[model samples]
Target: MQNLQSFASAMSRRLLREAGNLPALSGNDFASSKEIQRPLDVLSQGSGSFSAFPKSNEQITTPSLPESAENVNAANQLSAPVTQSADKESSGSKYSNWIFVLIFPAAILLILVPILVCRKRGNASMGPWRTGLSGQLQKAFVTGVPKLNRPELEAACEDFSNILNTFPTCTVFKGTLSSGVEICVVSTSISSIKDWPRSAETLFRKKIDTLSRVNHKNFVNLIGYCIENQPFMRMMVFEYAPNGTLSDHLHVKVYEHLDWAARMRIIMGMAYCLQYMHHELDPPVAVNDMRSDAIFLTDDYAAKIADVGVWKELADKAKATKEDGSSRSVSPPDLAGNVFCFGALLIEIISGKLPETNDPDCICIWAEEHLKAKSYSTLVDTSLQDHQADELEAICEVIQGCTDPDPMQRPQMRDVTSKLKAILAITPEGAGPRLSPLWWAELELLSMKSN
Candidate 1:
């Protein structure tokens, strides 16, 4: 009995010391005195008088009482399992807390990252792209682009009365409405594709959107559009350009000679139109096809741009490369490409011949050859009587800047507009270069010799 009491007293003291020394788990340690006492107290229940301990056998102590010994033995048996279970629970809680602290934030981040990325991509693809132009236009398709009723448009078109021009993708018709409004109708040809009517509707809808937003006297207005069944035709209506294309006047010689001042006026007007479309509109419009054929002339020699449409690159399975030597998935050229097209236009205006007369590469070279030699007279058309070297050079500067190979070096549309405006301000209407005092003196000398 003395030995058992001595053993219990020593073991309890050892357990208290050891509890203080158990290392931290996941940077959190159990407090020593309070925690140690809790488990030890539970373990020592019914083990009476732990404060008192019997000495060694030399003290001549009598045997311990039966009741006390039984209680001590029972408590000793229970203490081991209780202490073990408590230690296991403490270790398990620490491990669970450590795992949550490490993993919870990472799990949240993994979930949020993909969501943010998907939202950004979705907005870019589906929403209207913001532009540098005026903020009035948000979406490309605004409320003004209407979807006309099929029957009413057919009735107005006089049931496809006259064919104006035919094309592979669409057909043009000269339609005279009961209201006496003459409209040019371009109807899509949906015969070749699997389900092109649906796709063509998408195409025409975009066209309607493009035309509706364009507001200018120089631009051919889109009056209305028709999407009809029975024939399944999707057509857009534009106000007729009265005098036909500028190609007829310059190339075909249908009209009388256009003077230098008139030609410059036409060119300046065209530049202003381009500036409005490129800089003033939100999400700028780029017209890929700019040529003499694409410009229209009115009775008073007013120039209006025609056949304006967006060019998009699409993948073609049948052809390895396009006729223009571009990619299969064809998209519109950037702003610099548009500027290059303007350069080509300027070359046509100055030379009074088509860019196609020479090789596409040689066109710029031809201009450079003429300009560098100071042979300015050759730049003017045989039809034009007025010619000025200084004026032509000033106009040529803008053209040269636009056609530069490095896109970054090219002048912006706004800059081009400003430059042309300055030229117009200095130039007189209905006039040629003023005669100098040197020319008058030479004329006097010639008159004296004749006398």
Candidate 2:
């Protein structure tokens, strides 16, 4: 019984040893298996749950889902940062684009308004004088007397009185002043007259009387005068020159048909008139307004000095004088300076061109330069080409003398008139008609007299 019991104990101890060896083998198999980590397993077991190993072909062949999941998570983390950066860059670009669209057109409108307003105001101020033909006719009709004869002057005064009764608007008259006698009349409206201050009116009337007494053929004939008691108006009576102003013949675009003989006659007459005013008339009248428009022409083409009384009148008005007296407003040297203005007038008459303030080639300056260069041929009016060369040269010389810039160098009006007469006396009579091409071609069909 003791031997059998010892055998059972030995068997039990072998079984126990075998069981321990099998458990160690299973542990080795487990260690050889491919390792993979799950996110949850990692969190539960900590970083120590994963083991580092050299990969064999068998381990590489195993499904790598857990490793793929780890790679996918890493890739997603990196892509998220890239997308966030891209979104910020896109947002920054959009904001920059939005700011540029708002600021460019507002700057242009603020700069153009004032320039338009000034131009509008300037145009408006010139409206009265620049009004059309009807307005100009109204102004002319209301300002001066129409041409009349001595018998007609008498009839006109009677008619004027009758007209005044019918039209009270016609209150002023343009008529003759005969040795302090005021008679003969052509009437104008009191309201139609341009406003002149009371001081100006009294002064002008006195000077007009002085001018009216001067008797010369070339001087405008003032027969009589009167001033009615209206606030800003005055009237004068004078012999009217029927042929209109010298400027009409000199520069009229459609009606400029003065022949060479007529022009020469007119120029001579003008020279004589200027001479008489400057040398013969007592107190040496200075023609301050020497424009061609102030020169009147008779039916015989004789030049009569109109508005000779205007300068003295203006001077008196400026001085606030009322008494009828001859006052020398301009000095002798200044009166001589009027010769320069006369030269400009001559240029306007000779050439049909007006003096422009802007042109460097103004008529007087051009003529003087040409004269200095001995190119007198250039001074002849292009329309006067048919005129005798010697006569033209003489006229040019006279014009140059009159227009001299230095007042001291200008010839006296008496000398100018004497020279003009000599030239006229020598000029052949009845020269063939020389006409302005601009007027001649159009008016050829009409049988009007060349003069």
Candidate 3:
């Protein structure tokens, strides 16, 4: 019994020792084993078409994904040079484009600048000669006027020492050339610059151009321009009218009252000038600055239009506002405005009064009323008591037509000239000494020429 009990105790001790020696796995261990095996299962069950990586590098066959990755990496490597070459080509093209853009405008400027300079040089002419003031004297010799040397002009104007008239924009000096020819020097008040008031230089050039083209006995001729550098003076020169402006004759008591024939002669001369300007010239010059101040008489009493279109240039500065409230450069007055201005002058010539300053009773209005009433005798100047009534009425009708408010209705300068010429033939000899001695001599000369 004791032996049997000892055997059972030994068996129990052995079972306990075996059980303690073995490591026991919980539910977590079982889960980890299944999770690890699942990925291996998926790899082993991949499509049969792809073979696994081979042992020998020479026979290394890649599966589908690895082969695609290798091909993509190879494509990137091969395309690098092509992309770099395209970038280089694009960069070169851009550089060429930049160079072209930079050079084109500079090329245009280089071409255009010289052409403009040559055109300017071409305009330089001296009476029957092509002379240019490119290097030293910047004088614009217009028409066939003689190119007065700077030294000669300096001598004439006494180096701008004397001021005949001090005006707003320029100072006028009476000058005499070495050859005894008289000239008036007009100098700007501003110092030497490209332009004054921005548009002044342009207007001055325009004036020069107008004067250059005009060639009439009744239009003041441009002598030349004196543009000096050191003692900078921009000047325009014109032949001196010793008798002064027409304003002097009509307004000043020092001058003798113009007789009826003399007055008619003045009006006729003005019409001749207008015809020359508006009809004769290829591009007709619109002489709007038609005031007594613009008219100058020669020693022989021939009236010449001076300072043509200058005052208009000065007054043209302000921009004109459109009806729609937009601003634009004010253009020169149309031909109608010019006609109206000439009509104002007619009032002065007929009435022997300064028509410009007559405020409340504008002589034009008074003349219009008189004409409507057939008051022809009243239109004649009171100074000339001895005049033919029939001839005077005819003259009044001409004045009325010229001074018409509607420019379209007014007779053209050519028509006006024809009418005045007819009047001259019918005009009877005046009772008194009709004209200045010089003018009578000129008339006789003209008659001789006609014969």
Candidate 4:
């Protein structure tokens, strides 16, 4: 019985030592360790009903069986609390580890998702042609304007080997379709195309739609367009003008100097086209480009307006979008700007001066100075002498009104066309201006010379 008490006391002492040496996991664990240690101290001291340990020479007393059983029961009750506390501590540690494991990946996913989405969107915008034609070009297919492919364009342009003219923003290639019709292919280089903003593709499609709808004798006809992505090509095809640009006739002197009558006819053609655009169309299409080079001449010296179709691309090259690629605020139609450009073109035509040269002999400054002094003689082109004084005065008056300092004060294109018709002595019901009798004789002479 005494041996049993000593064994229980030694086991309690070992458990107390282990508990003291262990590190506490938390405040609750430390409190649990303290509560368990109190019972362990009572058992190790043998304070319940037995002496702690029997000495070698000291006498030992053996208790009754009931007393020994009671002592065993006390030891068991003390051990139960320690086992329960240990189980709780182990479970708590496992739960905390699980929480840490789950939270880390969730945080990483939150950070990565936005970055991936933004990258995908950027790539999609850069290659919008991957989705094929959507709004405008889809409807254009059934509207007489064909949607051409890269291979057909390549064959027509002779593998794009025939280059006609190269402008800063695009290249003009001369091509002949399978039907043996001549067409001009305007294409942008791949290097410069990379710099185009996201809105450039959208704007290009819209311009194609609008130009396809246009049907005017004085406007260049849009035949079809080609869109591709592998080599990144966007091209617009138009009817080839054989007589070349008005600038070529006037400034380059490749042909005979235009007489006063030829100039009037060219100006009248442009006016009629401008009137149609400004008054006839529902949402008026402005002549955004009015340079002399932009005007193509027919074999008969009639004017055909070109470059209006690709004005948006030309504008993008001049000015880029916002830094983040967002489009700028929408501006109202540029009808007033069109009126101003027409006035400048008129001055250029009359003075036979190139505004782009910006020389000391600039026509705009020269005309303004001469008109303020009412000096009509100096404003006429040096080559022109056959024009009557009254006719010259009427034309100068029109120029003055069109070039008014305030845009609001300028005459509408419709009014300008009416005044031009009146000056030509043609009624609205008349088919066209009566050809000058001398004009026919001169035409026959030129034809004979060419032959």
* Tens-place lDDT digits, model 2, residues 48-126: 2111222366341212323556556865676566556656765675565455444434444445556567545544332
Q: Write the per-residue lDDT of candidate 4 for residues 147-192, one digit (tens) a residue.
A: 6778777887899999998866778898875555567788875345
**lDDT of each prediction vs. the true structure?**
0.57, 0.50, 0.59, 0.63
Model 1 lDDT at residue 206:
58
Model 2's TM-score against the true structure: 0.48
Ranking 1 against 3 by lDDT, winner:
3
Which parts of model 4 have CA positions greater than 4 angstroms off? Answer: 1-144, 191-196, 308-319, 356-362, 426-451
- Model 4, backbone clash pairs (residues 3+ apart or across chains), number: 0
Query: What TM-score, computed on C-alpha atoms, does each candidate reach?
Result: 0.56, 0.48, 0.58, 0.60
lDDT of each residue in 1-451, candidate 1, tens digit only = 4554576678657655655454334221234432443232232212232312233563422233224454457656776786566567656755765687679889999999998997665444333212111222222333233345555555655776677766555677776554454556666655434333233344456556665666544555454565556555556666666566766777776566667777777777677767777886666766656677767766566667765443121112112232343333325437777777777677778778766642334577778777667676677778776766666877788878888878899988889878887776522222221221222222322232234
Ranking by lDDT: 4, 3, 1, 2
Mark the regions of model 1 whose C-alpha exceeds 4 Å error after superposition.
1-143, 150-158, 192-201, 308-333, 357-362, 426-451
For every candidate in turn, the CA RMSD to the true structure comes to: 21.6, 32.4, 29.4, 23.9
- In candidate 3 the C-alpha lDDT for residue 294 amounts to 80
Candidate 3 wrongly placed segments (more than 4 Å)? 1-151, 192-198, 229-232, 308-333, 356-361, 426-451
Instruction: Tell me the lDDT of candidate 3.
Output: 0.59
- The residue ranges of model 2 lying beyond 4 angstroms of the native Cα positions read 1-198, 230-232, 308-334, 357-361, 426-451
Candidate 2 deviates by what RMSD?
32.4
